[model samples]
Target: MADLGVKTPDVMTRVSEFMPEIITYIQTIIDNGFAYESNGSVYFAVSEFHEHPKHCYCKLVPSGMSNAELLAEGEGVLSGAADFVSEKRKPNDFALWKKSKEGEPSWNSPWGEGRPGWHIECSVMASDVFRRLGDPEGGMDIHSGGVDLKFPHHDNEMAQAEAESGSGQWVNYFGFKMSKSLKNFITIQGALEQNSARQIRLCFLLHKYNEPMDYGDSTMTHAITTESTFNTFFQNVKAVLRDAHQDDSAKWEGAETELGNAIDATKGRCHAALCDDFDTPAVMAELQKLIGSVNKYLETKAAKQEKPVVFVVKHAATYMTEIFKAFGLIGNGPEIGFPLGGAEGGAGKEETLTPVLDAVLEFRSAIREAARSKNFGDILSLCDKFRDDDLPELGVQLEDKAGSKGVWKLADPAELKRLKEQEAAEKARKAAEKAAAAAEKARKEAEAGIPPIDFMKALKLDDGNTPKYTAFGDDGIPTHGNVGEAPGEELNKNQKKKAAKEFAGQQKKYDKFVAKK
Candidate 1:
């Protein structure tokens, strides 16, 4: 049992499951009209509650927020109510309680027998837990969740509890979004999937908390490359320490001092940068400064002794560990989760690459025999070309000029070591960065406000050009308006060529996607 890492539920968390009184709080919210009942579900009337009006005071509605966006904000076309289909409200308004129909997971409720909503469960659960924890009258000090929870889940939780328990206060700090099931997402995950864990953590930490980040993959690679640049300095420090024992104590001592100062300066700048907004990138920029320091320290060690160098290495390790912990990063090397087996993130293509590696090995064996015979020119020539060309095609990173950092295989010792370091660094860096970013984000939002600026009043745009039409009717999958043609319009030769080209590309990409069928 101890090895299983099991833990019993806390009293507060378990309380809601047994309590009907707590359920009543959400029901009361429905009665008060802050929420409404649907067939059997409940939804919050989010438009009724005033937003932090200043949310829009800084062009926060999103730059170039289109009619499509406004349409997105409103439940206009997307909703299916026989009545109440007006665009008077916004999209940010979310359901508080979603009543379930038959076979859709329900709980018998006061509003004519339906299930409680996704949000209601949370509020009811929170209240029950708070009460069990002996803080029923006042709200919790913190109620945390992934950043995505804010708009609806947490917001609704705040609304329902305040309405019922007379406690409007809720979560104090909101953390940055995480990347557990990330490949399925669009933004930062795309960026993160390609980076060394260390780089990702550093970049994430650089950003202020709670602020949106337009995460990208290329930037993360840049970070990985930047950090690797400092390793030479580490080697230098090691050499100095090795030499110190044979030297004069005072002369050797300065080597330690130089290394210490370099690490301290990097650590301080990195820490301060993070303190502002969990700005990992800022910290990274600061940390990169140590690359030069490391090289300089190495150069000094040639003239200096070893003790100071050892001091630098030891202290730097501690500093690195702390930053790694804070930023959620530890690294062995750079290796992205390149899809292995089959289609879209399934597996790898070992079938083709495996035999090639074997073939290369056989050739290399002959080459080694030649080397033993002292075939200098031939051995050297073949070895050089072989090193460049003989790598496993399964995950060869031919584009990386500095050299491939190896694949994400858990087999080889060197590979495993690299993965452990990178993934650990990644985890630590993310957590630290999240904290820093969240704090800075809140401050920025609280302080940065430009007075409302005027804009040109454009004429009301209408999407009425299309005749009233029912779309994708009876077809669960949309027809792309017209599979081969644009409804009434005929396809031109150019359009047909382009469409054919696109279809072929998709077919090629998706067909061999999943590995081994």
Candidate 2:
């Protein structure tokens, strides 16, 4: 959770620690006529709770009451046992405390020596914490769990809490869900192994919390691409700011005014989206559009050979940084952009590497200057080697631009190396294809230059009955042979016909060769 930037809760509760409170809550529910004792067990009276005028059972999902399969699953493996079923007044009634079975942990409750049910412990713990925190009524503004819990689990918690406190409603809202039993769950540690926490967070941000999501390659790829896009935008903005001239007299103009308006509009839209059910997907879309506007503004200025207004660009970037921080995409630190080390120690690592990077870049600039002045090709190549090869291994990206000293930023060394390898592989593939094409072209040109007659002369065709004398014709095919045979007169009529066909084919190829020349 810390790796994902989730903060530690102010109070963490355990069912064992809250056993006395759980017993108290169950007794209160039984006293309120919303639960009943049967065969030394306690069960929440779902039908009675539903009939009560002040409260509604299954308020979040009333249809869940009819889902016998789901209710049985929520009640757990013991629910189907004959003894367990006989202990409940109604099938819909859920256990508040179960009678201890062989090998099962037991607690001393007013009903019997048995552990608290899965649902009741949550109510007891939550209400206990709320009361300690000064909410005398012991209700919550929100309660969250897996959607599977909406049926017998959360509804039961709501029913038990409301019954115990005599409150009309226990919580303002209920949200969120996850599971493992169907072999469809990924642990946080497992997910972190494949992707950074930011990428995982972004993946969730792209979807509505209440909606179902597929956590697979395509979703993660989109998250990675989105993260890269934001990183590139930040790098560009930082590059612009690096060279920006601080002028207090600089006023908002055409592009600046347009970008400023976009930033404000995006902020308003983001807030509205977040407020409307914490719609982060909409917020992300607005942010993407805002970044697009900023890119356009920068591109327009670059095209006109004018510098972007620093304050205006900074205003846009600062707002983006603020939103990113709010989302925990950016951490609480002096870092202005997404840290290259990801959620884990990225800012500190970047800060430590900055001095070393500056020194290397300064030395590289000097070498490059010398190479340009003295026209030292090897020296310039080496400088490029340092930028493209060496620095990336150290988690730095150096991008060259026309009329600039080039821009550098921190990045994942491994990712940069992989991309560099891909680039090199692509480059090698193109070069190989180009070389093969050139070789093919040269071969065709050489073949075209050789006359069909010369090609035939180069071949040693020795049939004893054929003529020995040779003569030329305008066409590359031989009209007279060394043996002085007219076409194929030295052989039979079939041979003559075959020879004529061969001559015709050769003559057609010679004509094509002539056309090319």
Q: How many residue pairs clash in each candidate?
A: 56, 9
Instruction: Count backbone clashes in candidate 1.
Output: 56
C-alpha positional error of residue 371 in candidate 1 after TM-score superposition, expressed in Å? 6.4
How far does residue 287 in candidate 2 sit from its true spot (Å)?
1.7
Q: Which consecutive 10 residues in model 2 have the weakest lDDT in total? A: 482-491
What is the Å distance of residue 490 in model 2 from its true position? 62
- Scanning candidate 1 in windows of ten residues, the lowest lDDT window is 450-459
The lDDT values for all models are 0.49, 0.78
User: What are the per-residue Cα lDDT tens digits for candidate 2 across 221-319?
Assistant: 788778878878888888888887666336778778888888899999999999999999998899889889989998998799888887878787788
lDDT of 1: 0.49
Looking at model 1, residue 144 earns an lDDT score of 47
Candidate with best lDDT: 2
Put down candidate 1 lDDT per residue, 1-517, tens digits, no spaces: 1111123555535433633654577677656556665544455555444342311210222322233444243322323442223322443444443444457655555755444545566777766667777886436764545654444445556666665655445445555554335543554444434543445555555555565554554445455555455433333343344455644444336556766777777877876876665566676566556656655665565455433435455466456545554444543322211112223434467864566678678767979888898887787667555444444233332222245342222122233334446667878989899989999987644332311110001111145343211132132212122324355344456644544454444444444543324
Cα TM-score of candidate 2: 0.72
Cα error, candidate 2, residue 99 (Å): 2.0
